[model samples]
Target: MTKIECILRPGKLEDVKDSLNKYGIHGMTVTQVIGCGLQKGRKEVYRGTEYSINLLPKVKLEIVTKDEDVDEVVKIISQAARSGEIGDGKIFTYKIDNAIRIRTGETGEAAI
Candidate 1:
């Protein structure tokens, strides 16, 4: 199993979600987050004043899937979230030790 986490521009959430659905990836966790990397954050003007917003709003999408699905999931996210611009987003993958379904007491791949 593997866990894939992607952080991207908030505006791209809907498109990414739809793409995942097309791939039959229906389960995921979405979170609103704030952070900055290479491009850092951008400056904005509010009420005639300029301010540096160091923490840009981003959407974090997390999904757990079988090992074989990792690459496909990452590709789907990348294709959907990309804007050919900075702050498009990033994806990270890691191994998942195990998972269990509480109600049915199912474990491992069966639980998923």
Candidate 2:
């Protein structure tokens, strides 16, 4: 199994989710996060003053899939999130040693 972690602009969440669902990836975890990359954040104006927003808001997705599904999943996310801009975000994939379902005591891919 492979674990795919995606950090994307908040506005792209819905599109990414829909694409993933249509592609048969139904399980995922989503979180609101704040971080900076090469974009180095951006400036914002509030109350007639300019402020450097060092950490921008982003959406983080955690999805675990069978090895064969890894490439497709990445492609789906990439297409859905692409904006041709600096802060479009990134995807990271890693090997998953095991997955266990506590309720049914299923392990390995069955748990996934």
Question: Top lDDT: which candidate number?
Answer: 2
Model 2 is weakest, by summed lDDT over 10 consecutive residues, at 35-44
Residues 1-112 of candidate 1: C-alpha lDDT, one tens digit per residue: 9999999899999999999999998999999999888767778999999999899889899999999988888998999999999889799999999999999999998877
Per-model TM-score, in order, reads: 0.92, 0.94
lDDT of 2 by residue, 18-84 (tens): 9999998889999999998887868899998999998999999999999998998999999999999
TM-score of 2: 0.94
List the pairs of residues colliding in candidate 2: none
lDDT of each: 0.92, 0.95
Off by over 4 Å in 1: 45-49
Candidate 1, residue 103: how far the Cα is off, in Å: 1.0
Backbone clashes in candidate 1 total 0
Candidate 2 deviant stretches above 4 angstroms: 46-48
